[model samples]
Target: MSPKMVPLERATAPAWRRRPAALLAIALAWPLARLSPHRLRGALEFLSRGAQPVTAAEAEDARNAILGLSVRHGGPRCLERSIAIALICRLSGGWPDWCTGVSTHPFEAHAWVEADGRAIGENPDEITHFFITMKVSVSS
Candidate 1:
């Protein structure tokens, strides 16, 4: 049987917090996305070293910030969004796990951030379909 997928709940943050975070994500995502995968992973690993885990609330807030920014700018692909989330988490004094993976059968690649082992803002089933090729843990 296929696993049930849970809908991600939107996180609420004060306008003051959301606005600035969204702006930062917008500013950083494009440049980061242009980088090659090796460089991007290295950059994320360097930035997230010794970082602490973000709370569930903080994870959600970062997810929302990325979404808001994506809407204003043209939508960024998953790698860009993941990079933005990781950097935003670092700025917030925590970091989530950043991951990149690909799926066969239908053939797709994706990137995402996870907090406490759960993929933030993603369908659990969709994430399960991908096998992770690279990951950067905040604590590493």
Candidate 2:
């Protein structure tokens, strides 16, 4: 079946989390995006190793922060966005499952972060059609 594109809602971080630190982390995503995929994944893996499990709420906060910063600074696309989210979580001493996947019918690729097996800021069904190409776990 062809994968359907779902319009995702933007998550908003709590006012308390709208600080310079979060924005700074989001800003760093730009340079990271310039790296090759392999290097990007390796960097994220290094940062995520031995990280604590990120709670749903924490994941939401990071997602929101990324989205917000992206709006203001033209946030990076899927891969960079996912990496940024994971890195933001790492800053708080936790990490989410970073993933990249592709769908065959129309040939699309996407990247996202997950906590407890749930994709953050994405429609659950949207990712079902994708075959995961790479997944980096913080605990691993």
Name the candidate that leads on TM-score: 2
- Model 2 TM-score is 0.82
lDDT of 2 by residue, 64-134 (tens): 87776565422226776787788888888999988889998778888888898788877688788999988
What's the lDDT for residue 41 in model 2?
Answer: 78
Residue 119 local lDDT, model 2: 89
Alpha-carbon runs more than 4 Å astray in model 1: 1-14, 72-76
lDDT of 2 at 68: 62
Give the least accurate 10-residue stretch of model 1, judged by summed lDDT.
3-12
lDDT of 1 by residue, 1-140 (tens): 45433333334443775677667766887798898889988877888888898876788778776665455322336677778878888888799888989998677788888888799877798799999999988756
